[model samples]
Target: MSRPESGAPTTTPPPTPPGESPAAPLPAAGPGPGAVAVPPSPCLSKVELRVSCRALLDRDALSKSDPCVMLLMQSRGQWVEVERTEVIKRNLHPVFSKVFTIDYYFEEVQKLRFEVFDINSSSVPCGPREDDFLGAAECTLGQIVSHKKITKPLVLKHGKHAGKSTITIIAEELSGNNNYVELFFSARKLDDKDLFSKSDPFLEIHKLDDDDTFQLVHRSEVIKNNLNPVWAPFTISINSLCSCNYDRLIKDQPGVALWDRGASLGRDVPHADEDLASGPVDGCG
Candidate 1:
């Protein structure tokens, strides 16, 4: 991970109110008690999103979690399931290959939530509602579009569990193309700023914007007590990294008190001609 650039501060947009929903009218109530209500037809300008989960909590009694993700849209303060992924058996880290298409109204804030469930194979004959709750993550379409790609840690409280998970989201506009890049980084002989003679270091990657300001694009986890730290590899879209401009000013910073001190760092930029399996580029400070 790289350190965020020290450029003009970016303000986060206010989040949509908790109880508010889209202006579209809800479907009529079900005729019988305990009947499920149908979802309203989605409106214009749809966008497709890819979702994946990492480090999900296992909820099965005798085996690892058979996780499935549910995509929901907020309507009238209630969540309506718009799409769901197939159950991935016994995997804590699951990449849902299904792409979800939802209405994208630039004028309105579309609140979205992703719920993870541990599916019991036996319950498959019944319905998805019978799956065990695992965890959930929530965000708005505006927030996702603004960032291009967002990775957030999932919380289990929303699903009534006490556990953690992570969700990676990539948004592809209906009319735009998608490009991806993989990156790996490491630092060596970093100055120790802490009293214990070791530094807690991380990385933030920022992309220079049109206004000559840097916007944070990716952040790495903090590595403790190690001058030589190699962060986990991550994949991000080229557009989100620098709007697809190879010459754009890409800034990498170390997240530590001694960042000002000379620390040797390495950066590996992916090449278009090379396979995604290629190794990271090493840099020396």
Candidate 2:
């Protein structure tokens, strides 16, 4: 290029910087130097401990007169019970539908079981042998495992100290034979999986007495797999079937106080006379 005369100025653009590519955008963020990504929290596994007259029993022939729901867990090594207190009194006009929710804190769950006992006839057989005057008892029991909703086994992760999960039991009497059921729960790792096996869980129940003292009325060990933990669910009933006799005592002593008087029952003991019947149930049907 030639320069003009005295007043003319020379003009030229500066060169582009080295290492700068005109066509390329800045590189997006990539993995940091030797940094590992953290894994996500594991999803919990759950099962609907469902029981229905339609699913388990014949409904058309069932009767409301014998409406019932009974829950039992195998605690320690014995069978302890949990029954509906209302159903015990409403033998003649029982409520048909009932449900309960149970949560699991991952551990040993002996067994979780449900029983629909018939009390219409005092002679109705109940229990495992089903040959007692208590009534007829039918039940379902099992352990917790991966279902269609949960394929990957529930994990407790390396840093997790404990795991908790809940199950909701919904029941509609529909016709008769009051529906009863429970969530039989247990836990395990994905690598070492056991299916439909039992888990042993523990529970404790304390009842307050009239003397303002707390007493242990029942102790359970492990019923089966989530079957029953001697310590957890305590079945108690105060029926008025023979209260007329106790009424005579109530008349003699105003404000008659009959409380739970017994030694501390442990999860290993199924039933002990120490867990005595306080007095009598004092309500009208």
Candidate 3:
């Protein structure tokens, strides 16, 4: 037997030198269960909304068959439609754009559908068909719906509304089902300084569905001061319906009636001006 010379058994090794650090254990070859790869940087999912078109360049050039874009804001469980008027100038190359204001109260809604409608100022029967006006031609318009994630903590200091933060969003087109797009956004909070106590804060949402009629999908109210809240992504499944003859829906002796009613309900179609100029022309083929 070997002689027992040591004061203590030597199985344990000596302490590591102060200058050395234990090797960082090799990263696990694969992610372990329950460890979701730190959920993809929310920024990776940002999406941007782009609205563009042909007829939008000239209001006078508008016709019943001219293509126009419609955006339906669906959020807080309500759906509101916005009609865009095309803007055109004499010298510009038919650039189109429109601005929509949100006037609903809701929370946790962040997806929308952009519907492309072919409208003929002549077809709606609200105005005289002008022979000098450009005959019905097809036009294209597009809107982008994008979002950004709060990569770093967003500190919305009580009064700071102009601070910008970057985030990522995933985007999908309302008309295209298989296409999914990603985008990044540098977003700033809306300045509510002008908002009065009675004035509701408006946030726009896009709805995706074939039905002109929309049901309340969800309902929510703003919680005054919730911190570090993470919202799970939600999607409104679209049920595509056969294109219906929407012309019959508008029945009027003069186009003014629909406009008057719309104006009363604060639901006036911004593009109603086109109807006024187009006159009461028959849309039925």
Which numbered prediction scores highest in lDDT against the true structure? 1
Per-prediction TM-score to the true structure, in the order listed: 0.45, 0.25, 0.22
What shift in Å separates residue 127 of candidate 3 from its native position after superposition? 12
lDDT of 2 by residue, 186-259 (tens): 22221111144533332223333334433332233433343322223233222111112345323432121111
The residue ranges of model 1 lying beyond 4 angstroms of the native Cα positions read 1-44, 128-131, 158-162, 176-285
How does candidate 2 fare on TM-score? 0.25
Q: Candidate 1 lDDT, tens digit per residue, 159-242?
A: 453355788887756544367878787766765655645665666555555655445455555565666777788886665666
Q: Which stretches of candidate 2 lie above 4 Å from their native place?
A: 1-50, 55-65, 85-96, 121-285
Q: Which RMSD does model 2 reach against the true structure? A: 23.1
- Poorest stretch of ten by lDDT in candidate 1: 268-277
**RMSD (CA, angstroms), candidate 1:** 22.6
- Model 1: what TM-score? 0.45
Identify the candidate with maximal TM-score. Answer: 1
* Cα TM-score of candidate 3: 0.22
Query: In model 3, which runs have C-alpha deviations exceeding 4 angstroms?
Result: 1-50, 53-65, 75-78, 87-95, 103-107, 125-285
